[model samples]
Target: MTDAAPQGRLRARSLGVAAGALPTGPLNAITDVDGVLVGHATVDDGADLHTGVTAVVPPRLGLPAAVHTGNGYGKLVGSTQVDELGVLESPIVLTATLSVFRAADAVLTYLMRLRPDGLSFNPLVGETNDGFLSDIRRRPITEQHVLDALEGACGGLPAEGCVGAGTGTTALGYKAGIGTSSRRLVADGAPVTVGALVQANFGGVLTVQGTPMPVEEVLPGVRHEEPPGNSCMIVVATDARLDARRLGRLARRAIFAMGRVGASYAHGSGDYAIAFTTAPPQRPPLPDDRLDPVFAAVMDAVEESLLNSLFTATTTTGVHGHTSHAVPYDRLPIRPGTGG
Candidate 1:
């Protein structure tokens, strides 16, 4: 696993900031789960365009999947079919709010070419409003952007902070973007991995390790371009033997952990979590009693992943010269063992 600081920024863990007691996978990323692949297509024109597409590709087709909505104010395409049929047919695509349908169509186009004989396909797509830093009305994302993300899918540590679907995102009064983390644990006598990737674009006080970050006190009149609430899209992947029902339960916990980082879940915030398992049980599934560890792992991974998003993101100036500053560690008190 390479260092989590991909863009000359520090990851939360690098500052000794973390959540929960569970150990992380080698890369501490969603790709830590074997066979899971992630890819991104960044459309930064250094002008009005600051949005892009992100793809989360599972190991195989027809995997058991589920969706949990914390607050359903934003668009999450293909969710009804995923909930009704309990399966994800195509790679999960994420982009700007207005670009969701186009991104879904791109996913459909990508899948149709592969399964030429198949009649119908359900493409999972989710989005958050990036209007503050992006000219969202322009709908800059293209079919090629979504397709490139799908085709460029790879394993290993994925990029984070101000990239892909997170390119124009803001959170907790600061710049935020794609972030990921994974946990390793044993369930029902079998080892399993649970990984999470988050697009942090919501609003709230920034909290870590039970302490609220003093964004106002430190920044002293920082730009608050976005409204009170926006949205956050979470994708949770695991190798545990869980079906749609179990995955739905898992998805709920991922959303619940948003409070760990002070997510408002405001009226307009669209908070959704999607959970899927790469390995469905061959024999009888692990009983419900064995799911406690996995549940704890999800909460921990989600909390840390959100923090990673903020810590690794740099100050960004977007459309109209509106700026969202990075977490000012130099002025703020956030450290390994103290409040920030």
Candidate 2:
């Protein structure tokens, strides 16, 4: 909950950023976006068996917003209205792939039980595949877990790596889980905030900046065999003034950042990005407004967020006796320009 003085170089467990180039907002996290809160429900039991849920709530005081990006590589429940009509009427939820149905149902139940005024609630939920370590087939996630994540949500520094839904995930052949980053942008003479949160379950060879360093290089004897059917669900939130169409374009740019970090969108990997804007609601009859500045902010934030996720993740062990090592802080290649 504290904003440590900005460092000359910010070094995360797995990734590092140049010290003074890009300005990091307070907390340097998705929560930097005002009113955005993140919470995790982690379930870890000794070795291997680990699972949990994460929740991202945008302004608990019922702020109206809209979702624009609608990719199909993975499942994002409650995006239909966001895409069709350009509005998000609920908090966004994230959990394991198999738990989407239960999570969504639980969210609905919470909303109705709390409101009780016949108000409709469309909950946003994103998922990533984590079957390699956990018994995904068993559907271990329950409705209560979803509720716990929701109820426990708060604003502050989010706990990363081996926590929540990221507990059993892997990224680029190494242990990976939830990663988040944020950036501040000034467009059209006003300051705007954009933030990104990711469920790191994608498969790729480890690479930094464009250096192709396969997982085997760092973790000797490891083979590039087919990874578990894994996928990543990235949720981006911003307060910039942008319409749904512009937001969709910004969401697509997140893939570019993913690729920069060495993800290939493999046939078995499900890579998806969902972006929304909490800019004041422009209800019916409101005059159309231009959103070029918001689009630019989205692109900048998505790129930085992806990098943060990779840097924050630490090595982890999961079910089936598989262990993914963390990126070696000493061995990573650092160029003169980019932070080492």
- Against the true structure, candidate 2 reaches a TM-score of 0.86
Q: Write down the lDDT that model 2 would get.
A: 0.67
What TM-score would every model get versus the actual structure?
0.96, 0.86
Model 2 error, position 130 (Å): 0.5
Best lDDT among the predictions, by candidate number? 1
lDDT by residue for model 2 (184-247), tens:
7676556777788888877777666567768777767765444576677777877776666666
**Which has the greatest TM-score?**
1
Off by more than 4 A, model 1: 331-340
Cα lDDT tens digits for candidate 1, 6-47: 788877777767678888999999999999999999999887
